[model samples]
Target: MTRYWVRAFLSGLALSAATAMLTVTASADKLFGAMEKAYVTNPTLNAARAGQRATDELVPQALSGWRPTISVFGEVSRTRSSKEGVPIITPDGPDVDSVAINNATSGNVSIQLSQPLFRGFGTVNQTKSAEARVDAGKQNLLATEQQVLFDVVQAYMDVYAGRQYVVLRRQDVSALEAQVKAARDRFAVGEITRTDVAQAQARLAESQSFLVNAQTDLARAVASYVQMVGQEPGKLSYPKVVSIPNSLKMALDVAGEINPQLLAQAFVEVARNSDISVAFSNLLPSADLVASAAGSDPDFAQSKDRSSAVQVGAQLTIPLYEAGAVYSQVRQAKQLASQSRIQVIEVARAVRQAVASSWNAYVGLAQIIKNTRTQVSAAQLALNGVQQEYQAGTRTTLDVLDAQRDLVQAQVLQVTAERNRVVSGYQLLAAIGHLTAVEVGLKVPIYDPDANYKRVRNKWIGTDVKTVE
Candidate 1:
C-alpha cells in the first residue's frame, strides 16, 4: 500500500507541472497588447491629453476679441420725504405757508451692447498665436504617448529577461546540489577525498545565494511591469524586432521633420513670433461700436413720470503715451521670440543625438547577442565533456564545477544581450518619432488630439465640457 501511494504521488506532481506549463503557454502576453493597455489607461498620457484640451480653449478665448458683448442693468429704490413751514406766492394773491409729506418708489433699467470694430489687428495676431500654441500642444501629446509606449517596452523586456535569469540560477543550484550529493557518495566509498565533497558543498551554497538574488531582481522587474502596463505581468513572450531607419543620416532627417519634441519647439517659435505682433498692436489705435437703451420712472404713483432714451455711438482709443509700458512689453516679446527660436535649434540637436545613440546601441547589441549565443553553445559542450571526463576518472571534481559555472555565465550573458537588444530597438523607434500607437500597429483607438480642439475651437456659447475616459 505504501509503494502504491508513492507512485500516485509522483504521478500527481507530474500532472500539476504539465498543467502549469499549459496555462502559461495559453496566456502568454504579447508586447503590443501591453502597449495598447498603457496607451489607453496610462495616467501620465491621459493627463497630457487633458492639458492639450485646456490649451485648445485658448483659441476661442483669443477669438472672443472679435465678438460682441451684451449686458443688462436694473435697479429699484423707495424714497420718503416730509416738509414743514413752506411759503408760496401766487400771481394775484398774498404769500401762504403750507406743510407737506410725500412718499415715492422709483425704478430704472438699461441694456447696453458693444461690438469691436477694430483692435489694431491684435485679434488676428492673437488668434494666430493661439492656433500655433494648440499645434504645439498636439505635438507634446504625441511625445508623451511615445514615451509611455517605450516605457512599457522596457518594462516588458526587463521582466522577460529577469525570469530567464531566475530560471538559469535555479538550474545552477539544482545541478550543484546533485554534484554535492554525488561527491559525498563517492567519498563514502573512498573514491573521492573529503576535500572534493567540501568543494561541491561550497559551490552549492554559492549558487543558492545567486538564485536568491536572481529571484529578488525578478520581483522588482515584475513590479515595474505592473506600473507601466497597469496590470500584473503573466508569461511574457519574446517581442519581435521593430523596424528602424536604414541609415544614420536618414534617421536624422526623419527626426528633424517629425520628431515630436523638435516639432513642438518649432511651433512654439511660430507662436512667439505672433506674440511680438500682438504686443506691438497694443500701441496702435482701437475702435468699437456701442449702443444702449435706458428707461427710468421718477415716481411710481404718476404714470406720465416714466422716461426712456436710446443712444448709438462709436468709440475710439489711441495709445499716445502709456508710461513706456507698451514699448517695454514689445521689447520683452521680441526677446521671448528670440529665446524660442534658439530652443527649436536646441531641441533638434537633442533629438538627433538620441537617434544616433539608440541606433548605435541597438546595432552593437545585435552583434553581442550573436557572439553570446555562440559562447553559450561552446560552454555547454565543454561542461558536458568535463562531466564525462570526471566520471571516467581523467578529470578532477574542480574541472566539472568550473565548466558548469562558465556555462551558466555564458547563458546569463546571452539573456541580457537579447533583452538589451530588444529594448534598444524600440528606443530607436521612439527617437525617430515612430513609437506611437498608430505607428506601432496597436489595436487600440488612436487618440486624436485634434478632436477636442475642433469641438471647442469655434464654440460660441455654453460651459459644458466633454469628459475623457
Candidate 2:
C-alpha cells in the first residue's frame, strides 16, 4: 500500500514539473500591445508632444518678419480756449470783457501696412534659425519617446526576473519540505536522531521565508511597471526573452554615432550654428517698404472735410554700435556650438565603454547560466546518492540534509543567472539607442515629426509672400 501511494506521489510531482517547463501565460495581453497602449495613452508622452507643437510656432513667428504687417490706429483730443469780443480795444480794455470757450476735438483712423524689402538677409537667417530649432525640438521629442520605451523594457525585465526568483524559491521550499518529512520518517524508524529532523525543519522554515521575500519583490516589480507603462498589469507577462544583438562589432559601430539622444545633441550644434548666422545678419543694414494711407484734412479744425492719399517709400535702418552687444551674442552662440560638439564626443566615448562592458557582461552571464545548470544537475545527483546511502545505513541524515541544501543553492544560482542574462540583453539594446516603439514591435500610433510644423507653415500670408530665397 505504501509503495502504491509513493508511486502516485512521484507521478504527481512529475506532472507538476512538466507544467512548469511549458510557457505559462498569466497575462492575457500581449507584451507589445500593452506597451503600445502605454505609449499612446501616457500623459507624460502627450505632454512632450504638446511641447513640440509649442516649439513649432516659432517658425511662423520668424517667417512673419518676411511678410507685411498691417494695423488700424486712432486718437482723440479736447482743448479749452479764452477769447475777447473787442478786437480793436487796448489789451487792458479787452481783458475787461474776456470770456472762456470750451472746444472738443477728435481723431483720425486708417489702416497702415509695411512690407519688408530687404533685411540684410537677417530675416532669412532668422527663418533658418527657427528651422533648426524646430529640428531640435522634434529630436527632443524623439528622445523623450526613447526614454519611455526604455522604461517599458525595464519594467518588463523586472517582472520577468522577479517571476523566475519566485518560481525557484518555491522549488527550494518544496524540496526542503520533502527533506524534513524524510528526516522525520527516518527518526521514527530509529535510523536518525531528533536533531536531524530539527535541522531539516529549520532549513525548511528559512526557505519559506525566502519565498515570502520573493513575493514582495514581485509586487514591487508590478508597481514599477504600472508607473512607467501607465496601467495596472492585469495580464502581465514576458513571453519572449530579449536576445542579444549579433555582437559588439555591430554595437560599437552604432553606439554613439546613432543613438537617438546623442544624435539629437548633434543637431543642437546645427541649431547653434544657425543662431550665429542670425546674429551676424543683425550687424547689417535692413530696408523695408513703409507706406501709409488715410482720408483726412491737414487741419483738424476744418468741418466735414476729408481727403485721402497714399505714400510709399523705403525705410532703412543700419546698426552703428550697441556697446558690443551683437558681438557678445555671436561669441556666446559660437561657444555653445563648440560645447555641443564636445558633448557629442563625450557621449560617444561613454556609449562605447558601455557597449563593450554590457556586451561582455551579457555574454559572461550566459556562460555562467550554462555552468550553473550543470552544477545543479551534479548536486541533484549527489543528493540522490546520499539518500541511497542513508537508506543503506551508510550515511547520516545530516549528510543527506547538507546535500539537499547544496542542490537548492545551485538551482537558485542557475535561475538567477538566467534572469540576469535577459536583463543584460535589455541594457545593451538600450545602450545602442535602437529601443523605440517601432523597434520593440509595439503597435502604437506614431506621433508625426512634422505635424506641428506643417500645421503652422500652411497658413495665410500676403499674396506676394512667396518663399523669397
Query: What tens-digit string does per-residue lDDT give for candidate 2 at 194-230?
Result: 9989988998898899899989988898777766765
Candidate 1 lDDT over 1-469, as tens digits, reads 9999999987975675556445554588999999999998888999899899999999999999999999999999999897876555568664456666689999999999999999989999999999999999999999999999999998999899999999999999999999999899889999889999999998999999999999999889877876777667777899988889889899889988889999899999999999999999999999999999999998889979899999999999998999999999999999999999999888988998999999999999989999999999999999999999999989888998999999999999999999998999999898899998888899998889888888998999999997776
lDDT of 1 at 418: 95
Worst 10 residues of 1 by lDDT: 17-26
Question: Which residue pairs clash within candidate 1?
Answer: none
Instruction: Identify the leading candidate in terms of TM-score.
Output: 1
Residue 420 shift from truth in candidate 1, angstroms: 1.3
Residue 188 of model 2 has an lDDT of 89
lDDT values for all models: 0.91, 0.76
Local distance difference test, candidate 2:
0.76
Q: Which TM-score value belongs to model 1?
A: 0.88
